[model samples]
Target: MNIQNVTVIGAGSMGHQIAMLSALAGFDTNIHDVNEEVLKQARHKLNKIMDKWVGKDKISMEERDRAFEKLYFTTDLEEAARHADLVIEAVIEKLDVKQDVFEKLDKAAPDHAGLATNSSTIVSSLIADVTSRPDKVCNMHFFFPPLVMDCVEVVKGEHTSEETARLAMDVCKRMNRTAVLLQKEISGFIANRILFAIQKEAMALYEDGYADFKDIDKITRKALSHPIGPFELMDLSGIDVGYYVMLQQYAETGDPKDKPSKTLVDKVEAGELGKKTGKGFYDYHSRI
Candidate 1:
């Protein structure tokens, strides 16, 4: 279960956070992406976070230096996964793309190494089917803010081994994440399912003309103690991303309730995609 080197196969927000946390937790973390620009951005983002940690006295200079030192950057996927004790795929949330990646990992990953998917909603079974060694594959879904969030959903594929799950759980522990093993993979896993259910109701309320966006958000913050409302979370997470997930949910569950709101579709179409683009349910691009 002990790991020295971990390879994160994508250098997006979650992947970068995973790389930083893994390195901070004493693993030689390697991050790889197809694009060089993304790799550079990931390093920049992690360095900024680490600087903030140092300023807050949350991490010592030695620890920060060690984290930066332990992290290796790469653009070559095969080379990065070759010697890694564990490989975590955090690429786009597409089943075929993920399956393609895992098929390669089946060849590249070490025999004893574990393979995990950071897929938020895609079924682990589908991903494992494409993997030659399904027994070594499982879902290790970390939330948006990997460094700050503690919950790591350890989803077990039907054919996934207990040993593999144990090792994956141990890996989460090393990264200081709370690992909760789900006996089976359900659509949206645990957190997302609960989250979307609430979202469905909210959307219904807004669509039925019972409430407006700001009022719903204000009520949730004041009454539910939720820092951000579902709409706000969707904006931060990317409206298009949330819309795609809702579509996937509808396709899987055959429930109309899982369908996303028209406002989300319109916003995405208008290219007003949440925080990344600086606007969605709100605007941030102006820095006003």
Candidate 2:
């Protein structure tokens, strides 16, 4: 597709990193956020991160300057999407909000431009119908910490055409990400589905009084050789995010078991959203 301009909606954790990666890959990247404060924060955070990379000799100062030059930020959504060859929506994980953004992008972006979402679980088919170019819409799910995560899931929704999927894969390649192709759409995709089951079982063990949460984390790390424990991982990813994802899954399947654990719900209600909030399953306030 020879994508040149990449637009990333939302300046949150994922969106900023995705835009930075796109710029690093030599694509002119535009990042849009409705909130001006968020755009400022993203710009500051990205600059700090790039400086750190340069200090560590991971990227040269010239490379960092070039990347920063290619990056642009704005509060205007249409302005960001106007001439974008690829629009990757990384907004909040609400179906209605995503549908609204996609609908507008369909009109604002050029007809030949491809549309994609960075949603972890929500399928493009569920939102594609609202847009005129359903064939161009697909899921390009990037993992958390987009800068470090090398794998991107390229999911093909029912209405998504083969050419669109291939173009998304190519886009991932251009961003220096390895694209994992999913032939069919599924909730939680592959990695999250497996991790969800493990977390469910871990929570069950803790709730059943078989082990302490910390012990379970220790066991998983020691026995399974995982870098982080389930609870700690939840803390990193934010309990509120997991809570909403579980609620979305339950809403879709109408199954009580799909609901989030009481522990997660309680933490979220207490306003302990995880690293961002300085508290989750663990306390980050003291350490940080």
Query: Candidate 2 regions off by >4 Å?
Result: none
| Candidate number with greatest lDDT | 2
List the candidate 1 regions with Cα displacement exceeding 4 Å. 286-288
In order, the Cα lDDT scores of the candidates are 0.87, 0.93
Residue-by-residue lDDT tens digits, candidate 2, 1-288:
788999999999899999999999999999999999999999999999999999999999999999999999998888999999999999988888999999999999999999999999998999999999999999999999999999999999889999999999998998899999999999999999999999999999999999999999999999999999999999888787788889889989999999988988898899998899998878898997
Model 1 clash pairs are none
Pairs of residues clashing in candidate 2? none
Give one digit per residue, the lDDT tens place, for model 1 in 1-288: 668999999999789998888998899888999999999999899889999999999999899999999999999988899898989999987677888999988888888888899988987888787767889889999998898888999999898999999988998888888999999878899899888878878877888999997799989999999999988888777787788887777778897767777887788789998888888877786766
The estimated TM-scores of all candidates read 0.96, 0.98
lDDT of candidate model 1 versus the reference: 0.87
> Highest TM-score: which candidate?
2
